[model samples]
Target: MAGFLLWLLLLVFCWPLALLALVLYPIVWLLLLPLRLVGITVSAVFAFLGALLMLPARMLRGRPV
Candidate 1:
């Protein structure tokens, strides 16, 4: 029950773009997937690096940590 509610909230908040993804899935898979995959991978790598850089600031604040 609690897990389901948590998962629902997570899905709602994290996947707000899911509907758009669903609509675009076929088109993306058929046409854009290969082209976009490289960009996606690069973007993910940059985002990860950005998050890693921010981790020190977050930890130093001692807020959540």
Candidate 2:
């Protein structure tokens, strides 16, 4: 992919920094994992609230004969 190509370019141009990034990537992802989970949870909660708010209107709309 583009990222791998970019990293390969970096490795050719500067191995040390590229290695540092390679090593740090997992640590950075681990640190950000909780934040990603929180974002997903927040989105789900908002969706549930939206559905709850719409329930009454949907109920009253009823089905056509």
Candidate 3:
């Protein structure tokens, strides 16, 4: 696509910047890893609580108490 071609041209012309970003990307990801972990933990806890709240209703349906 045109976007890919443009990106390729940019990479060719700006390789040093690209390389710098490549080296720093992982470090930045590592620095933000704890935030990602906290988000995941919060999402999992909410899902668990929802499932627990739904359990009684599921059992009352008599489908498989």
Candidate 4:
């Protein structure tokens, strides 16, 4: 019984720490998520556009565009 109560008390105290970590995850992700998304989008857009712009030149060279 004493061991059971100690286990229960440990859980009661530890649960909040776990809960706080869970709650903070979204906030941390939200803060950094946009920068990651925007970086990917910008890089992709630029790479695609660069490829398009270079395609004609590549074709003129009789190489794979």
Candidate 5:
């Protein structure tokens, strides 16, 4: 993979920072995981509500809602 090669090159060129990233990436991902989940949940809830509110009009139009 190009991405792997890029990181491998970075590791070869700058081991300290690359290693730091390797160590910290998961920590950052874990820290942000809850926020990502909450965002997805909120978006889903809003989408469901919107579809529910639209259903009556869609039915009136005979649109096969």
Candidate 6:
């Protein structure tokens, strides 16, 4: 993948910073996990609201001739 290649390039160019990033990646992901879950929940709620709002219109549209 491109990310791995980029990281490899970084490792080749600067091992210390690359190692820091490698070590910090998991910690950063763990910190951001809750935000990601919230985003997914928000998106699902929005989708449910949209479907609920459109229900009547879909019901009235009925079958095509």
Q: Write the per-residue lDDT of candidate 3 for residues 1-65, one digit (tens) a residue.
A: 99667657767999887777768879999999999999999999999999999998988898753
Ranking of candidates on TM-score, top first: 2, 6, 5, 3, 4, 1
Candidate 2 shows a clash count of 0
- As for TM-score, the candidate ahead, 3 or 4, is 3
| Model 6 lDDT tens row, 1-65 | 99999999999999999999999999999999999999999999999999999998898889564
List pairs with backbone clashes in candidate 5.
none
lDDT of 1 by residue, 1-65 (tens): 99667656756887765556556768868797777888999999999999999998988898763
Mind giving the per-residue lDDT tens digits that candidate 5 earns over 10-49?
9999999899989999999999999999999999999999
- lDDT accuracy of residue 26 in candidate 5: 99
Residue 43 of candidate 6: its Cα lDDT?
100
Q: How far is candidate 2 from the true structure (C-alpha RMSD, Å)?
A: 1.5
What's the lDDT for all of these models?
Answer: 0.79, 0.98, 0.87, 0.84, 0.94, 0.98
Greater-TM-score candidate between 2 and 6: 2
**Candidate 3 residue spans exceeding 4 A from truth:** 1-9, 63-65
Can you give the TM-score per candidate against the true fold?
Answer: 0.44, 0.94, 0.73, 0.53, 0.87, 0.90
- For model 3 the local lDDT of residue 30 reads 100
Output the lDDT of residue 4, model 6. Answer: 100
Question: Cα deviation in Å at residue 15, candidate 5?
Answer: 0.4
**Model 6 residue pairs with clashes:** none
Report the error of model 4 at residue 26, Å: 5.0
